[model samples]
Target: MSDPGFRTGPDGVRWRDLNHNGVMDPFEDPRLPDAVRVDDLLGRLGLDEKIGLLFHTVIETGPGGSVLDGPGAISKTGTRHVVVDKRVNHFNVHQLGPAHEAARWHNTVQRLAQETPHGIPVTISTDPRHGFSENAGASFSAGSFSQWPEPLGIAALRDEQVCREYAEAVRSEYVAVGIRAALHPTLDLATEPRWARQLHTFGQDPQVVTELGLAFLEGLQRGRLGPGSVACTAKHFPGGGPQADGEDAHFPYGREQVYGGGHFADHLAPFRPAVEAGVAAMMPYYGMPVGLQLDGEAVPEVGFGFNKRIVTGLLRDELGYDGVVLTDWELVNDNHVGDQVLPARAWGVEHLDAAGRMELLLEAGCDQFGGEECVEVLAGLVADGRVSEQRLDISVRRLLMVKMQLGLFDDPFVDEALADERVGTPATVEAGLAAQAASVTVLADEGGLLPLSGSGRAVYVEGLSAQDAAALGRVVERPEEADLAVIRLAAPHEPRSDLFLEAWFHQGSLEFPPGLPVRLRRIREHCPVVVDVTLDRPAVLGPVMEAVDAVVGSYGSGGPALVRALRGEARGRLPFDLPRSMEQVRTHHPDQPGLGDPLLPCGHGIPLGARV
Candidate 1:
C-alpha cells in the first residue's frame, strides 16, 4: 500500500525511500501506524544492523560543524566508519558549532545514512546545552542556543510555568540544529550537598523535582511524541544522589552509592512522574548500590546498568516501563583520550571482560549502550549463540519504534536557513536572561543594604569583570577607594587533578579556603560588602555569610543577571538548604533532605527591598 503523498526516486521530498527499493515500503509510509511501520522495518534488518541499533556512542563534528572524515578529539572513529561500516545510527553530539552549520552537518550525516543498506536515519542526542557550565562530560555552554540559568536555578524559582517555558526554549533551539534527543532534566534529587553533579539537578525536594520535571518533560515533548517534539531521556534514574560521601560515581573513588538513612523511597519518588509521562528513555547511573534493599529483597550490588533486579525487575516489571533503557556513558569499556585512561565504570562487574559486561547489560534489559561503538563484540555474541538472536530482536524493535515515532523515516533533513533564524533569537535570549535574574536567591541583607542606589557610587569588585561592574557604579581599583564593595564567589570544592575527566568535575569539600573568609572580612571593614556566590553545589558558607554584609546565591547567572537581582528587579528563593558548617554536612544522611542544622533552610530567601 503505497501512499501518493510520498515519492521514491529523485522527487522524494515529503518522504524518504529508506530501503531504496524504488517504491514506498510500508515502513516509509507516514500514513501507517508507528508500530506497524516499526515491525516492517524490524523484519528487514540484518543481524549486524539490528546490533548497530542498540549502541548509542559519541560522535564529534569538525570545526565549523564539518563532518569528521577521520578521528576526532573525542570520537575514535570517523563519521563514515560509524555510519556505513558499523551501521550505528544513534549518536550523542558534543561541542557543536553555529546552528546553521550544525544543521548542515546533520543533513550530511543523514545523507550518509541514506546510502546504507537499510537507510536508517541517525538519531542525534545531546547533554544539557542551554546553561552556563561547559564541562565536556556533563553540559556545554550555550553557544548559539538561548541561554538560561542551570536547572538548579529553575528549581530555585519554584515555578512550574517557568520550568515548562525553559524546556520549550531548549526544545526549539535543539530542533533548530537537528538534534532529536535531550539527555537531561536530571530528576536526581540533590540530597547530597557535596555531590559534584548537582548543577543540573532540580534540587532536594521530591515534590518540586517531580512537578518541575514533569512540566519540563511536557514542554519538551509537547502533547504527543512526534516529528515536532524532541524526545527527552530523563536520566540517572532511581536517583543518582546520595553518593556515599557526596562524591560522584564517575571516578573509581566514588563508585559506591550508600542509602545510609534508608531514604531510598524518597530518592525514587521523582522518577514515578517521568515514567508516568511516558518519557522516551531512562539512563541508570554508574553508582553501584552498597546496601540497597527493595521490598525485603537485597538488590544486586552492581551498577544499575548491569543489575537485572534494578533495570528489568524494578524498572520494567514493578514500574511497568518498556521504554528504551540507555546505560550512562562508558559503562562497558574503558575510555582512553590521549595519555589519560578512564576505567570502564563497571562497578561491581569490573572483573568481567567486555563481552561478559555486554551480555550482563543485555540480560538486565537495557536496549542501548551509551558511549560505546563496539558493534563487532555484540555481533560476535549473537554469532556464537551466547546472546540469542531473539533477545537482539526485542531491543531492535524498541529502537526502531522510537525512530518511527520521531518521524525520522519520513523526513530526516533539517532546513539550515530556518535553523539560523530560529536559534538564539532576541526574544528567546530575553526570556533566558529574565529566568537567570529571577533565580538569584538572597540569603542575607543586613540593614536593607540591597537595591543598590546606582548613584555613581564607587564600587570595588572581586571575581567580576571591571567592565560589568561599571554598569552598577564607578569601578574602583581598591576597596578603600570605593563607597561599597561587591564580591562574587563560586561554591568551593577541593580541586583534584589525578585524571583528565576527574579534573572537569568539581568534587570534594564544600568549605571555603581558610584565608578566603579572612580576606572577605578585611574587605567588609573598608565598606559595606555584598557577596554573590554561584551555588553550583551547596557550599558550607558559614564564614563567608558571616563576614559579608549581604549574601546572595546564584545558580548560573552572568553579571547582568546578578546586577538585576541586586537592584531589586528580580526575586528568588533557596531550592536546597545551606549547611552551617562542614561538620553539620557530614552528620547529615546522604539520601535525606533538610536533616542537618541548616544555616538557611531550603525555602529561605530575602526580597531585595524587603526589610530585614
Candidate 2:
C-alpha cells in the first residue's frame, strides 16, 4: 500500500521506503493502523537496528544545547556515536538549556536520526525537572519551567485536581521543548519512612498513590497518546519501597528490598491503578525482592529488571500490561565516569557477564535498557544464538508503536519560537506557585505562634535570608532583638561521604546531629521560633519538635511560599507519618503502613484561623 507519509524518489523509488525495497512500506503510511505500522517497521529492522532500539542511554547537550562530542558526567558515550554509529534513537537527556536552545538541539539531533537508513524520529525522555531538588541522578531543578513542589508536596496537598493540574503544567513545558517522555510520577509507595528516594513518590497509602498517579498520567498524557502528550513511565514497578533497614537500592548495601510484613500485594496495589490508567511504560527498580512470595510461589530473588516472575509473570501476564518495560539505568555494564566506578546494578545476577546480563534481561521481558549504550553486546548475543532475532521483534514492535503513537513519525521537530513562548508561561508559573504554597504542612503551633503578624515585627531568621525577612517585616541581626525567629532547616540525614553518588541518595539515619539540636534549643530559648523544615523524606523530628515553638513541614517551597506558609497564606497536610524519634523508625516495618507512634500523622495540618 502506498502510504501518505512516503515521498516518491526521482528514480520512481519511495523516499520513505524504510526497508529500502524501492517501495512504500505499511509502516511508512500515516493512514494505516498503529499495529500495521509497528509490525511493518519491526519486520524491516536488522539485528543491529533492533538492538539499538533496546538501548535507551543518556545524552548530554552543550551549554547552548548542541549535542556534546565527548564523554560527560551522566553519559560515557558521545552523542553522535550513540545516535549515528551505534544506531540508538531513543535518549534520556540530561541538563538542557533554555526552551528555544533545547528545541534547536532537539531538531539538530532529529536531523541526525533522519540521516539513518530508517530515519526513525528520536524519542527524547527526561526525569522530573519541574521541581526544586537538583539531584543529578534523580531529577533536575526547575530551570526554564515553572517551579513547583516535589511529588511528596503534591501528596501533602491531598488534592487530586491539583495533582492533575500540576501534571498538565509539567506536560506543557516538556512538550514545548521536544521532551516526549516523562521518566516519572514515581508510583513507589513510601511505606519505608527512611528510603532516600521517597521525595519522588506520593506517600505510603496505596489509594492516595493510585489516585495521584492516575491524575498525573491523565494530565501528562491528556488521557491519550498523541503529539501534545508526554508519555509517562510510571516507575519503580511492583513498588520500590520496603528497603531493608530503610536503605536505598542505588548502592550495594541497599540492594535487598525485603518485604518482612508479607505484604507484597500491598506494594503492588498502586501499580494496578497505573495500569488501569494506561501508563505508556514501566521501569523496574534495581533492588532484588528478598524472600517475596506471590501466588504461593517464591519470586526469584533477582532485581526486578531481570526477574521474569515479576516483570513477565506478574506485570505482563497477570496484570496484562503490554506497554514498554524499561529497566533502571546501568544494569549491565559497570559505569566509570571520572574517578568514580559505579558497578552494574545486576543484583542477584552479578555473577553474569555483560552479555549474560543482557540476555537474561531480554528473557525476563525488559524491552529497553536505561542508561546503557552497549548495543553491540545485544547484537553479539543474537549472533551467538543466545538471544533470538524473533525475540528482538517483540520489543522493537512495542518501541515503534510508542513512537508512532507519540506522533514522532509525522513530525518530530519542535518550533523554537513556540517552545520559548510556551515554557514557563505566566499561568504555569502561577499554578506552580499556588501548588508550592499549598504543600506547606504546619506540624506544630504551640501557644498560637503561627500566622505570625507580618507588619512591623522584627524577624530573626536562619536558613531564610535576612532580605526575605525584610519583605515580611523588619530584619533583626540577633534572635534577642526580634519578636520571633523565622528559621528554615532541611530534614537532616547522617551524611555519607563514601562512593561518588552515595551522598546524593540521602539514606541512612534520619536524625539530627547532637550539635544541631543544641543550637536549635539555644535559638528557641533566645526567642519564640517558627521553623520550616523541608521534608524530602520522613525525618526523626524529636529534637526539632521539642526546640521550636512552631514547626512547619516543607516539601519544596520557595522563600515567598515559605513566607506565605508562615503568614497563614498557604495550607498543606502531612503526606507521611512524622516519626517521633529514630527508635520509632527502627521498630516500624519497612513494608507495613501506619506503625509506631507518629509525632504528627499523615493528614495532619493546622488551619489558618486555628493558629491565630
Candidate 3:
C-alpha cells in the first residue's frame, strides 16, 4: 500500500492552483508526503517553532530521572528550551503504563497537541507496551497498554515465532492506545555481565538478534498504531552492552564502558542488523568510547552523542544510516547528582556546554535532542542564525516524515478495547515468565545437586521477593533464620560513576559494600551457601566462589525464574557467560569466556521437565 514516490517531498497529490496564486497549493491535495507538508508549514513559522521538535525532554523524578509512567506526578521539570525568545510547539514523550488506562493519558496528551496551531498530536512511545514492564522505569501503572513477557523471556525460549508474537501483542497495544512508536527489542546481545539492561535484550548471538529484532520491528511498526503499527526507535545504536568494566550508563559510582582492548565489534554486531531491518529511528548511547570516536584521526574523551566521528562518521556515514538520531538523555555533565553519588566521571574530556552539545549533535546528523532541558538555548541559536534555516527544514521534514509513516495524520483516537485485549494476554504473560525461567543461568550446583526440594530446611533469603524465594524451597528473609542463605541481588539501580556515566564511561573500584563477601563466608560456615546475582554485570564473586556451595545468575528478573532455577526446576547458566570474578569480567568480557561453574559449565541448562 506504500506509494513508490513517497520519498519525494510530494506524492499522492495532484498539483492544482488553489486560491489562484499561480502556484500549486497543498490546500488542494490528495495528501502529500510529510516532508512537503513540513516545508509548507515551516514557510509560515518562526525560528522557535522548528527548533522545539528537535528536543525530547524527560520527565524525571528527583534522582531517578524520568517518572515515565505515572505512579504520581511527572518528574524533572525544565529550566531551558532550545529557543527562549518565543514559545514553540512542545511534545511530551510518555512511557505508557497498562493498556486499560491509555485512554485517559491519550486524551490528556491529545488535548494538548490539538490545542497547538500545527496540532501535531503528540506521538507517545513506550519501551514495550505489550510486555509487562512497558515502562522500563519501575512504579509505572495505569491502563490501555498490554502487558506480556519482556523480550528476554522470549529469547529464553529461542522460538522466533514467540518473539514475533511478543512484538505483535506490543504493536496491538501501541495502535490501540494511539501511541505511534515503541522504543525497544534491545538487540544488545547480552554477552557480558555488568550491563544493567540485559533482560531487555536478545541473547548474545548476533544472528538471533538480527532475525528477531526485525521480526519485532515488523510486528510493531509494519501496520497498526494510530492508522499503522507503532514506529520503533532502535536503541543505543551501534549497540550498548559492552560496558567498560561492566558498568551501566545510568548508575553513579558505576562509571565507564570498559572495552576488553579489542572487543569493540561485540557491541557493534547487534545494530547493523537493526539498521538493515529499517528501524524508524536510532538512539545514541550515553557512553563515550575512547577508541570509537576518531577525532580528526585521533580519539576523544567525549562520547558518541557529542562526538562527530562516532555519531556522524561511523553510524551515519560508514553504516549509511539515514534515520533520526536521538541522544540518550542529558549528555551534558550532571551537577544535579548530590550526595547519592560517590565516584565522579572525571576523565579529562572536553566538557562542552549544554548549548554546544546540542549544536554538535545536530551537526553530527542527530535529528532529535533527547532528554534535553535547554530548548530555549536551541531557539536562541536559531534566532541568532547560528543554526541554519535550511538545516531546520531538513530535520523537521524528516521528523514529519516519521509522523506520517506512523500514520498519526490518519487515525488519532485511542482504542480502549484494543489496548485491553492485546496487552497482558494470557499467552504473552506466560511467555515472559518462561523467559525468566529460561534466562536463569545456574552457575554452580555442587554435585548434580539442585532442585533443593525439601533439602533447604529453613533457607535464608537476601535480596529478592518472598514469593520468588518460596519457589526455591524453604526461604527465610533473615540471614540467621536458615540452614543456608541464598542472596538474589537487584541489578545496579544506582547510576554509574557514583558520580555520572556521561561524565566518564569507564571502570571504577566499585563493589557490594566492602568485605560483604566475608560475611557470606560466615553464612557458608553454617551449611551450603547459594549466591544469586540479579545484576546486569557480574558482581565480585571472591568469597562467593570460595565459600558458596551453589551460584545462580540472572538479569532484570525479580526472582521468579531465579526461584525456579534454585529448585533445579529450570536449567541453564544464563545463555551468556558469567565471569570468574570482577577482574575476569573487566578483562575477558565481550571477547573471551564466562566463568567455570560446575553445575552450569558451558552449554548446561537443557530443560529438566517440560520440552518447552
Candidate 4:
C-alpha cells in the first residue's frame, strides 16, 4: 500500500519521494519494511550464525578455474558451516561472462545455492569485472570488466557526462552478472607524483575527482540491479598517496600514515562529496598516521578502517557518513616476499587476539571486514562466549540494512547472459575512445610544427611497430622508416614474472627508454620530427622536446582524444600542469604534488589550426 503521506509525482527518480512521505528524500531510501531479518536471525542463531557476517573471508579456495570452481569445491567440503557449499563466496574467482567455462561455473554455483537450506546466494564482486580481459591477478582485469581508460586517462576530458557514460557502461556490465558491489571509483587524492597507485585517481583536481566520482557512484547504483544495486566504494580515505618511500599500506609495517604535507584536508574533500552523493560504501585506507591531532596529544592513528577516531568519530560523527566501510584486502599481514611487513601497534587495545581484533574493528566503527578471515575467528569467539550475541547482532543488522536498502530481496537474480549487452558496448567503447583522445597534451609546438600537412616526402615513426606506422599511413622499423618519426609509446608494466602481476606499482616517472632521445635526435637531424609521447604523464623531456620538431603527449597509445589531437580534429589540452624540469618536482612539494612538473600548465590545449 502506498503511504498516504508519500507524493510520487514526476520529479524523476533522483528527486522522487523516496521516504513515501508525500515529499522528496533525495539520498535516503523509501522507508523500508523493517528488513529486520538480522534481529530474528540473530535470535535464532546459536553463536555460530551470529559471527558469520562479521568477516568477509577468503577460504583456502584456489582460483579454481573461474566461477565454476564454487560448486565442485562446496560439494567436496562436506561441512555444514560451508553454508551454501560449492557456492563459497569469494571475489575475483569468477563472473567472466564470455568464457564458456567461467559462465558455466558461475551458473552451477547459483543453481547449487538455490538448493541450499538458506539459499544465501554467493555475493560476487570484481575489481572491474566485464571487459576484454579476465585477469585474476593484476592491477586491471584483462578478460572481463570494461577497462575504460584508467581514471587518469579520462580526467582531462573535463566532461562529467563522459565520466557518467563510463560509469553507466561499468554498471551495465556489472549488473548483468551478480556483482552488486564495485570496489571502485577510487577517489583517493593522489597528491604525490612518486606514488605508484596515482594513475588510479581521477587527477590532481579535487573538483574534477569529486564531480566525476559522484557521477560514477550515482550511475552505478541508479539501476539498482536485483539482490543489490552495485554499491560503489570511494576508496583509501585520508589519502593514500604520499606513502613514505612510495610503499603500500596493505602490509602491517607500511601502515604508518605520515601527514607531513599540509594537504590531508584536500584528500578528505573528495570523500565528503562522495558521502553527499549517497554512495553505497567506502574503503578506509590501510594507513594510519603517527601525527598528533590539533590537541597536541599523540594521535598516531591506526589503519583508517579500524580507527575509532576516524571511522566512528570523523566519518560517522562529524561528517555523518553512514554506509558500509570495507577494509582494503588483507589488512592484517604483508603479502610481499622481501619487504617491510611487521606487526602493527597503535590506537586500539594493546593486546588483541583474533576475536579481540574483530571486536576492536566493530567498536571503532567499521561495519564489515574484507579479504580477511574474521568470520571464522568471530564465530569461534562467539562459541567461546568471548563476543556476545548482542554485539554480533548490531553488526549483522547494519550489513542487512544495506542489503535491504539496495532492494536485494526483491531483485535477487543474476543473468549469466546479459553480460554481452554491457561489456564495451558502443557507448562504452566510445567513452574509451573519447578518453583516449582527451588525454593527449601538446607541451610545445613552436612555429606551429604540428598539424603536419601530409606533405612530408616520407613519414617515419619510432618505437611504433611497422604495422602501426602503416596505420598512420607510413612505415617504420626505426625512425629512419620515413621522414616523420611518430613514436607511439606505451608504458610497460613489470611483466608478470609469476603469471600474476605482483608489486603492481610503476614509478609513472618519465625517463626515456635509454637513447630514445638519440633515436629522436637522429630522426630530427634528418627530418622535421613528430614525437608522440604515448604515455599518460609528461616525462622529463628537456632533451627530447628540444630535439623534436613537435611533441604530443598521446597519453597512452593515443586514446581516442589523443588520436584526434594528432589528426588536428580536437584541441589537445593539458588537464594538469607538467613541471618544466625534474628539479621542480624535487624541490616544490616532492612528497605529494598532484602535478609533477609544469612544462605545460593545466588547460593548455593547443589548437594547431588556430595559428593566428
TM-scores of all predicted structures: 0.97, 0.96, 0.74, 0.80
Compared to the true structure, candidate 1 yields what TM-score?
0.97
Clashing pairs in 2: none
Ranking by TM-score: 1, 2, 4, 3
lDDT of 4: 0.56
Could you tally the backbone clashes for each prediction?
0, 0, 69, 48
Candidate 3 displacement at residue 257 in angstroms? 5.1
lDDT of 1 by residue, 80-164 (tens): 8999999999999988888988998898888888767879889999999999999888999999898999999999999988888
Lowest-scoring 10 consecutive residues by lDDT in candidate 4? 71-80
Worst 10 residues of 3 by lDDT: 1-10
Candidate 3 lDDT over 525-583, as tens digits, reads 77677776653444554445566777666544446656665565455434454444556
Question: Residue 309 of model 4: what lDDT?
Answer: 77
Tens-digit lDDT track for model 2 on 402-457? 89999888677788878879999999898888788778988877787778665688
TM-score of 3: 0.74
lDDT of model 1 at position 534 = 95
Worst 10 residues of 2 by lDDT: 1-10
**RMSD, model 2, all Cα superposed?**
3.1
For each candidate, the alpha-carbon lDDT, in order, equals 0.88, 0.85, 0.56, 0.56
